[model samples]
Target: MTEAAELPPAPQQAEAVFGDRFPEAVRYGELLADAGVRRGLIGPREVPRLWERHLLNCAVLSEAVPEGVSVCDVGSGAGLPGIPLALVRPDLRITLLEPLLRRTNFLEEVVELLGLDHVMVVRGRAEEVLGKLPPVHVVTARAVAPLDRLAGWGVPLLRPYGEMLALKGDTAEEELKGARAALSKLGVVESSVFHVGEGVVDPPSTVVRVEVGESPGGVRFAAKRAKAARTGRARRRR
Candidate 1:
């Protein structure tokens, strides 16, 4: 059994912890369990940790995400954060962008099975797709890439005032430091980190929220040209 299952049943405890958000969390938990069963992604014994590690881990970031915003979850595999976020915040429109064909298919099925109309799945890499779309209010990611690469993927898709919320492990601070150069290249100027629950897992989780800022003339012009060149190459290869 997963670690989460070994612990005592926490349904009531979870409800008290989440308050009004409990019902949705529980329902989504069921959906995740069902999806895992149908896809054989996890053994029946593994559902509990999947619920806690994947679902709740992502759900807590909802506290960091601002309300009434359009957000995109980059490289969303199996729709962890995006799907759970849609369940909790019915008002926020979430787009899940996945590059792999099979994963994208899985995401679509999960959304349909869960009756999540607020979630949309796009098939493409973030670097290729993010620039084409209009900037969104916020971007989220989990286990997709390192902080530096994630910043590169997310910054281009964010409005000047938009935010990027990344679910990371204990090395979040170190990753943020490593990502400083990349962030500057992408026009992200400020960042904040928040630690989530303790003792749920080793090397506990944190959320890194990055804020986009105005790029200087030379930097902005250079970034635009670089993006254009990259897009051109991608189309040529296609």
Candidate 2:
């Protein structure tokens, strides 16, 4: 096997972004460089720029999240925004949701090693967990899928008035424009594109924020939720 590339030192901005959890951030970076590459969760080429492109890029997402809210990171491959967000914000409860077993295993280990009591690793696709997992205040994703398709998976898992934050690149605005109709169908009352990280990271991270109203996943999801509630009531009676 090829040797893993060296993880670059955390940029000076990381200290300010991660605050007291800076050490944990460094440890996470090391793991991403080492184990993350070995397991094919992340490419070896990504190791050298892990801090600037990955960690800090995701960590600054915390600025867009509300205080003391629950968040689910969909398709949390290698736990990008979820783990980094957890490192910075202890107050926010985070669930790292990944469909693959190998990736979930890595996330579980990282959570344990970091002692991130606030973070949970769940293995399942976003559609599969819709009714099984409680809806959260916010759903986060990065490089998962197209904006419309991704909204279909992430929006239904949110509580009323919750938002879906997607970390995109230059195509953020373009995707939002293309997905506007799909977003409307998913009960997205408002949608926009914005950037985070500013001085913390050059160019900053572009994000597509999709906010839902009272009916988070639209009409069909409401019916599904009602059915699930009834099923739960029946089970309780049994």
RMSD of each candidate relative to the true structure: 4.8, 5.4
Which candidate leads the pack in lDDT? 2
Residues 27-145, model 1: lDDT tens digits: 55665566545664445675757656776667667677788899999988777688777876777989999887867877787778667788889999766674476678899999888
Q: State which candidate has the highest TM-score.
A: 2
Instruction: Compose the digit string of candidate 2's lDDT tens values, residues 121-220.
Output: 9999887787799989999999999998898889988999999999999988899999998888788999988999989888899999999998765537
Candidate 2 least-lDDT 10 residues: 217-226
TM-score of 2: 0.91
Clashes of each: 0, 0
Residue 112, candidate 2: how far off, in angstroms? 0.2
* Minimal lDDT window, size 10, model 1: 1-10
lDDT score, candidate 2, position 158: 91
